[model samples]
Structure formats: C-alpha cells, structure tokens
Target: MAKNTGASKFRKVNVDEYDEENFQDNEDADVGVVGPNENEVSNFLNQSKNVEALKAVLQNPPQGCKDKRLKDKVVQVVVRVLSAFKTSDIEKGVNALDSQSLDTLMKYIYRGFEFPSEGSSATLLSWHEKVYAKGGSGCIIRVLTDRKTL
Candidate 1:
C-alpha cells in the first residue's frame, strides 16, 4: 500500500479544455418572457406622456393570451403603465373608455390585483377611488358588478 497523504485524491478539472461546440444553450435560462414588441410597448408606455398610445395598447393588447408567458408580459406592461398614471390622467382615460375599453381596464385591474408583489394593485385601487371622487362611480360599479370580471 502507498503511504497516506493529506492531498486531494480527485484530479483538478481544467475548464479551458471543455469543447464549446458540444455545449448547448441552457434550457432553464433565467431570461424573462418579454419579447421585443413587448419591450417596445413597455418603453413607449414608460417614456411617453402620450395617453393615446396607452389607449391604443389598452384597446388592443397583443393576441397571444393562450401563452402564459405572453399573457404575463402583456399584463405586466399594462400594470406598469397604469400604475404610472396620475389621478387626472386616469380620470380622463376612464372617461374616454367605451364599453370594450372598460372591459379591458377591468381585466387589467383584476390581473393587477392577482399579484400584489407587482405593486400595481395599490395604484389600481387608488385610481378606483379617484374615479369615484370624479363622479365616475357608475362606470366602476358596472365593471365591478359584471359577472365576467371576477
């Protein structure tokens, strides 16, 4: 038998010797779901003061709702934009909303509240209060009472 020693028995790995071509991209990458279009939309919503852009996005969200990742991205963008709205801006936006837009807004509110860590729920609630204060209670009440909303 060989004499005992305190040195490690295992050989050291030389990372530089690994073949790069054989390595595939990680399937579980931490990259988020937001695509370029979603990024553009979120950027426009964040950087632009134009309410019309927001109105357009709210009126017609990107249509891949079947994909949970896409749906989450859409919801995230909407909530971020809505959370940035001022009371007057929200009141004006609420007033300009037709029935369809109102439904969309209600969806946003529901989704916003679904994930509290996003922090948009508080903004939505505050906006609701502002709507009531602006005498738009009927609109909010109609949305809240809608069977499709919950």
Candidate 2:
C-alpha cells in the first residue's frame, strides 16, 4: 500500500466522490491480489524458490551434467543460492526468476558448454543478467568460472 502521504491533516479525509482513474497507477494497486490494471499479482519470492528445484537440478538435470567442471559450477551455483535461504524459502525465490534465467541454470546443470575454457566476461554476464533480471536466485558464480576464476 502507498505510504500515507504525511497522514491526513485531521487523521482522515473522506470525499463523497471517489474517482479511481484519478489515482496514480500504483496508488490503486492491491497487494496479494491485483495489479493496478487488475491483473493477477504474483508472490515474487515464494513460488519460484523451492527445495525441489535444487533437488531437481541435482537429481535429473537436463543431460550431460556429469562433467566435473560443469557439475562443480552447477553445484556451486545451487549451493550458493540455496545457502541464502531457509529451506522453506527456495520455492518462493525460484518462482520469482523468469523462465529464461531458469533455463540458463537448467542448461548449466544439463547442457551448458565449457567452450575451451575461455570466453567473454560480458557473454557470461549477459547470460546471467537475463537470469538475474527475471529475479533468479543465484549469484554470478558461473560468470567467474567462465572468466576462469575457478
């Protein structure tokens, strides 16, 4: 909810005529329910973050996740991200990230290429920016590995 703007001069202001359209977009927004335009709202940090996701990556990754480097990278990424949350929080965090970001992680765990162990920092960062922008949980560790920091 919008913060009370300096409170009302008399702690309450009631106008008989209420025009919702006059309010700014967010002003009329409802939490845990609807967006300003009345679209369904999401719980950003809950649904996506789940213990099952980490477990899923470890258990039945896409394919070819057995490479030591790729395994370590995926493990590190999952561990690092999972470390920050209580077991209960994973589902929420996972839900928050966008599909593309999740796909990147899935690729890393399943099919991401090692590529001669040399590549652009920008390339990795760009990959993760998509991940992070969609609110993915992991930090930029794969970025470090791509840069040979591992």
Candidate 3:
C-alpha cells in the first residue's frame, strides 16, 4: 500500500483535508500597501518602474503546462507595451520604451502572435500608426509619435 500525501492518489486537489476555518480571511494587498479587498490600480499611479513589481509576480507564478520561457517573454512584452500606453506624458512614455517597448512591439507583431483580446496591446498598433501618420505626403513629413502614448 502507498502512503497518502494529503492529495488524492490521482493528483486531484482533495478538499477533505483543507481547513475551512484557515481559508477565511480578508487582507487585501495592493501596490505595496494593504487595503480593503478592491481593485489593485494604485500601482498605475506611481511614476516608478513597474517592471520590478511585474517581475515579482512572475517569479512565483502558478505552474502551467506551457513552456515558461515563451509565456514569460510574451507576458513581458505585453506588459512593456501596456506600460508605455498607460503613461500620460510623452516623456514618461519615451522612458518606458527605453526599457524595451519598440523592440517588443515589432517582435510581437513579426512573430505572428495573436493580438491580445483585451487591454492596450490591442489598441497600441493602431494608435502608433495614427500618432505617426505616414500619409506619403513626401518632402520631409514629420510624424509626432510619442514614446508610449502612440
């Protein structure tokens, strides 16, 4: 006979051993602070680099069956692009790009990755084309493409 390791023999999550009492708690964590259980948007307001925060999230993310490196790169690229889009100022957007936005954008597009179903990545490509319109106006046509705003 094999020893039982709390989990079901078939690797399913058996709820029988789970402590119902221990699972009930309400401590909301958000953007380096504790608050009520609500949307965690506080980080968006900060002017600091959000990459560190995102890296922390991926460091111990849920174990999935897919290749982690590919998934991580995809997620990272999306985050960089989205981060650029979120910043309101052109300078800030430009700063975000330095970390890796333009390269990521072209890479994602060239790789034939599917467009994100939600959020900024879905909108950024069009937004960029709009900001820096290449209307074939010729004779030194200037495009006002911003770092992240586009």
Off by over 4 Å in 1: 1-40, 62-64, 129-150
With a 3 Å backbone cut-off (N, CA, C), the pairs that clash in candidate 1 are none
Report model 1's TM-score to 2 decimal places. 0.55
Better of 2 and 3 by lDDT: 2
Give lDDT per model, in order: 0.62, 0.40, 0.37
Candidate 2 lDDT by residue in tens digits, 21-87: 5653323222231111101111211355344444343333323222455445454444333443554
lDDT of 3 by residue, 1-150 (tens): 998678756777676658786574333323232111112222532445444333332233212224456544545444443444443543334333322333333333333234454554545554344323322222112212322111
Worst 10 residues of 3 by lDDT: 33-42
List, residue by residue over 57-119, the lDDT tens digit for candidate 1: 575543333456666766777777777677567777667766666666666677677667666
Which model scores highest in TM-score? 1
Identify the candidate with maximal lDDT.
1
lDDT of 3 at 111: 31
The full ranking of all candidates by TM-score, starting with the best, is: 1, 3, 2
Q: How close to the true structure is residue 108 of candidate 1, measured as C-alpha lDDT?
A: 67
Clashes in model 3: which pairs?
none
